[model samples]
Target: MPTIVRASVALLALGLVVAPDALALSKRDQAAVEALNQQMQAAEARYRDAMVKIANADPAGNADVDGALEDMEDVMAACAKQKGCSPTTMLTAYKRLLKQNADAAAGEETPDDGADDGASLAADVPEAARAAALLSADGQRFVKMVQYNPAVQAGIRRWLTDMRGPLIDTYENYQYMRQLMWPQFERAGLPEALLFGVMAKESNGKVHATSRAGAAGPLQFMYATGRRFGIGPDATGFDTRYDPRSSAQAAAEYFNERLGQLNQSIELSLAAYNGGEGRAQRVYNSTGGRNFWDESVYNQFPAETRDYVPMVIAAAWLFLHPKEYGLTFPKVDAKPALLRLSRPSSIYELTICMGNGGTRDGYMRALRNLNPRYQAESWLPAGTTLSATTRMVGLYNRWCLQGQRAELASTLVRSNASSAIVRTGPVTPLPAEDAEIEGGGVGAAGAVTTSPSVSKAKSKPAKPTSYTVQRGETLTAIARKFQCDTGDLAKANKLKAPRFAIRPGQKLKLTGCEG
Candidate 1:
């Protein structure tokens, strides 16, 4: 008799009353209890798997949460059909056992605001509809502040519906650049889950994202708000708001400041983060220390701010407890590395050649996140190095070298929409034979009429498909030595004739050559 789960944020927000009669079960009924226990255990395992993705802020994690929720719903439906057992009764029974275990550990550890372990927090909280400040044994922390309310339940339901896809996208984006941003929140003694929640909603983890209201960055800082937290533009014209590390640091400090003025309430702090701190402060001061979700205080904020507060909390809640929602986050191989380009290329070209076979999503977003200094289409010189994942480095070596995929990627990136259309201006076609040699240019016959610098070379019978030019060598000499048309060689290298100066290390295509 496994129970169904999926309600996620809603599950935490929804309240229930356990049936008093199920408390006393005879020995003969133990078999039914055992079967139900097994089902609950399986659902929890799936929940744990989904939480890892939320921990990493990966978007695909929601799928598992969705599955778990559906399973839980099924269980609940079945629970209704059970004669003596009910979903509420079973959940309460499980919760009570967990609390007993936590109470036993109370002698050794406190539950909240004092380095609470995950096991203790999970056990102590009623779980059906309660809030707690949770800290893992290893020091990771998250505040489950939006627990057990109709409004919050509505928010969770919304997350399960429309926000599902964006949640995954945001998480995936955040995970790729977590190295650049997570440490900021950690240093500020803030919950990384809060960071992910804010970032997911504000910018979907896109560093360059900006709102119509002039908010920018992963945290969506406004110009004035960013400056207050030591984040703005630098001398080099790079906006610090667009820097994930700087923006996250600023956001952490900003949240801490808001917490101080807003009675240390995460809900109030978040309301201010979305609305204005001044407006939120006024509401708080006028309401005489009223809680953020208090009808009086909640009604004072704008409609958008009211919605924003619960959504942020729900997202943060999901980040901390994706398993409860049945979401399993996908693990990403984000080991860092430096990738040097083998040839002149752009991020656009690299992204195409470096496939997403290793990751759930393509590395394009990851690439852009890690290397924000250049635009995707910016052409980088050969040997230019970029911050990249180990997977990308391996892919670059295998597929982005001088290969078909590499060439195709380059071609794809270079293809211009305007170039695809016919040119409007009159065109000059090549002459059939040698034409007037103007300005020491190459004649149509592949001869230089002036500029003796391109002196003809000694003849040779051998021929090759390509040649690397030596120092002080001229295009005329190489063409003559190969017994090929010089103009064709000039066209191959996109160089003019006459003073066809060739430099050392220059590779020439011997097109139209003859032995």
Candidate 2:
């Protein structure tokens, strides 16, 4: 069921509605009240059937759902005016629907990482006019914000099917950063769901995620665009675009600006966000403020944007109504806290010292996202403070402060690969094996030929231009292994100092290094 029906049904079932004095009313009014209650029940039945069909992707379901809701509202309105109607009597019927929602939610399979899965739709009104106002003013306004077209339906289908993992990850990551990000949108009078949609589509809530086109951060603001919104690089050369609070604030301002210019069209504003404001504004002006869905407007934006707008809307729709689709979002214990280093430590060390604590990945990503300025391998000095969740801080105290695991983590992070290899005096070689062997030949006696080249031809092994970092490796270690200056390696990799932080699997240029 849609949000309206579910919330209304829940509030009604929870006994928010009050009963009228039946004995004081005439017998005719009693009969009218009873009839209205029966109508409400029938409408509710139809609403349930329509919800099922809607869940199954039936086109007729939307109309039927709306019709049933209207019918129920009409009955409730009439009963509010009727002398002896008891709103409590509607509870028994709706309680079943409420239980169904709970059961459905419980039945859905949660992913191993975590697939996890709010507002009263209606108010109990003793007065008829108040009841009508409550229904019109409060419960339905949220539902009216966006259009759920076929494009949105397709987007929803994709999210529920192939894109489900991304949706879950976005939800999980957003929860960790919600305190930092959501307040910006909330203060701007924007919907929380819209914020989720944009972040979900843009970066799946990865704080340091950068697009190939040069957009950076959780909200994916380009360098120039971010500067306009007070989210450019700081004096220290750290881009605030990667900061959740800064980026979300910029995003809120951006959407408000676009919405104002685009006649309050969310699709248009979203188009501007993805396709560039210049194109979106130009299309808006040329179309004479036509709806974004109009062919003249829709066709003007690039295909990426055309897909983006709908996907964003669909995500927002699901955000508001997850139970309706049987989708669950995992719960995160993300209570924010500050962690002052008890000793100098890197995030890699901290991650190793602090166990997973039931999370699939350790707290590494969360630490990186929350404390973007520091690289995962960058050593944070004693007394340096970092943003963290309460759970993480607790874990740090329990497992990372001064234990054997903590020492092991520190030792691991400090390890150097170059120290492990030793050089010995050159020795006699054996006969070479088959010449057809790849990567040079081995000897038949298992001792390889020591010649630099075949037939006295002097040649050198080509140096590699790039290298992929391996796990538990560092920039200094890599530089040592390749017999290159650490400073030169960092410069080639464009790594920032003093952190010069690098993650495993990140590619680096091997300029000035022997490979």
Candidate 3:
């Protein structure tokens, strides 16, 4: 029999949204509402899955599942206090129960079976089974964690009830990556749950994920690290870290190596992954060679690393038991397979080719999310086969095809617009009738009399004032410097009227200004 954990009830209470019935909802009206609800539920499920996967795959350390549960309960209580909020929302109710459970679990120690399944599972299960098993364990642990942590339980409840849409979407995207990457992770002997943790820390599932430190893949590998693991950096400036399969494989190898060196402890290995190995080792040594939670170990690391472990653990725990935390994870329309691209194309180009569909952006986001080794300023060259989620293959293919056309069109346009300017000399003043024929229309010369000052100024050719365009300067910049309009500058220079493109060190005529 499937064990129905009562903790989920608390989340339900906290997460349910109840709009006031000023207007009765019709069947049709409720249809859209129902659809939205389904979508939110789906998203919640996805997030939960991703979090579980991360925990399952985590080779470094187990997250603070207990703390996350506490937070979830606290969030539930706060939501219960809200006037319009419903306690039935999954998030709200789950948190409430989680807090209650946490309180109940405190100081209650189960007899030690000496099994250490979590440790055994981490070591024995291949990447795939481990992911599945860990997720299951993570869910159970989450129940225990929330039952222990009142503060996190409340936060979880509030997250589910308020802003259900965004939270759901985040979780959905996270799950999409999980389903797509599980197989590769299984083959690599790495925990599948680690992917979610990486995604959460690196991009929060944003595909076009870029870091300030120049990490660009979903796994967030640096150039040197990626290359060391067979995801090469090529002459065409191709960084294989952007390729999901390649990056995943590389990350697996890296993690495996780290584990081998770190006494096969996922916690220490993960600590090394986030905060350098040296620091993790130092923390381990300082803690008298105990696990990650030791006060000495926690204090030895940076604040970010200290916070990072708990966050990863929390996400992993939530993924396993989203319902317990009043969190929903969404299911994405993605396939589980390697996608081969015959031609090389950019994410931007591929997005256009995919008929502007949902999958294109999703894939691009995943690639950007997982492959932190690729730089955005450069484009991935052609003939690169990328491992993509099955759902995104068609869109990626379309993007490749469209990219070729876009590239060709751009090239043609550039060729046609060479630097040579065809000028019809300077404007020559003509008789009124001829001027009317050539220059659209004009008043009779005598009728449009110039002022004495203007006539005198025209009679004497204006002094030639030359200005040079500097680096990082545009026509607008130059115009601003001289306190003149860009249109005026262009006209005086006899280049064009009201439009101009300037290059560095290019000379321009400044009119009606003393410089």
Candidate 4:
């Protein structure tokens, strides 16, 4: 009622345009607009219910109720006038009202009605103390919204396409690893679903994934955390986190420890994983030791952690019901099988070894897609046998028959010759062990012993440079500055704009520009 009319008028002005020159909308467009308007009406009804609840609960806050109602009217007016505003916009407005009401209620002191103390926080509490009281309720609601949000579901669909077979293969690998680690999860009484969520978030199911944070494997367990759970680097230079089976076990154990300390709440355990256990513990203690969704808990952590629980729940929901959510998961021609290579090889080397048969290019793409943690483009390194489907194995066998391993090894030697020579220097010849490990045991055709010094002398390379674009600078201007065409610049940087309207701090590639 308060300022609702003024807000509605303003929104209508911004959203609707009735002009003589305006083109008539098609029947389909009109129908779509009507649908959006109906969604707005539904959203408004829900918002009004929330406002009524707020007014009834807080006797002294007619002002908050008035503001909420006004905002709702404005949002509805905007939707009606535009006829193109999505359900997302309407829903967002409703949620904003609910959040504001919740925040206000959390800040005041009110008598409890013998409801679960974990359901909400006491009013009149300080900002820091309020999060613990409200986090549980907020967390539950957040998870629900994420599970149902159509836009979020659409995003997951896009991600599935980009990830395709590699993610599926990795998920299958996770099942195998989970089997070996189930005992640990069972012993800890931790939810099995938590592992899947963690794996998806950390590495998109890639067993060999590593993070910049030094968290390794599917769970992204750091060295300290891994050590705490009895998983770490071994004598063979294998970090247990890189091994699917070992990492799964360690993740289960670590999660159990957090759950034990945090009242068996998965939300709190997750917060500890993203932020830190000590911070979570401090927050829990500050919020009267309630569950993670207590309003008091939200007030304690950073914004990233506030959103993390919802994201995790969203991912879990998608994984459980990909088809229901309209996600087109990749179809596998056949179930993937793990192959143990007798010799160590890099992913690059393995690609060459698996040569041009039965979709070898597809196999390499899948390997890169699955193992994003591998920074190097090629070579899986020696002693590391990779898991791939039958198709990949057939390709690898074909490449082996062609006798191209030596050729590939020669290319690698030539490529890395400069770095190898520079690092080893003249007096200290390349170590035999290092050579064998890096060279992947060069073939009998002088592949292994190709002189690094000789190769370095023959290869010629150019240096890289940077370029800056000024105000009103076109792609043509920037390209000309670097002595290259506009098309080359666009291609190199993947610019989609017809003409470059470069903004400050926008980097343009000039590394390969010709004079």
Which candidate number has the best TM-score? Answer: 2
lDDT value, residue 484 of candidate 2: 67
What Cα-based lDDT does every candidate model obtain? 0.67, 0.75, 0.50, 0.53
Which lDDT tens digits does candidate 4 get at residues 291-310? 66667786688987866665
- How many residue pairs clash per model? 20, 4, 89, 36
Better candidate by TM-score, 2 or 4: 2
Instruction: Give the Cα error of residue 410 in candidate 1, in Å.
Output: 1.1
On a 0 to 1 TM-score scale, where does candidate 1 land against the true structure? 0.57
Against the hidden true structure, what lDDT does model 4 obtain? 0.53
Q: List residue ranges in candidate 2 displaced over 4 A.
A: 1-143, 431-515
Q: Is candidate 1 or candidate 3 better by lDDT?
A: 1
Winner by TM-score between candidate 2 and candidate 1:
2
Question: Considering every candidate listed, which one attains the maximal lDDT?
Answer: 2
TM-score of each: 0.57, 0.61, 0.44, 0.43
Give candidate 1's error at residue 319 in angstroms: 1.4
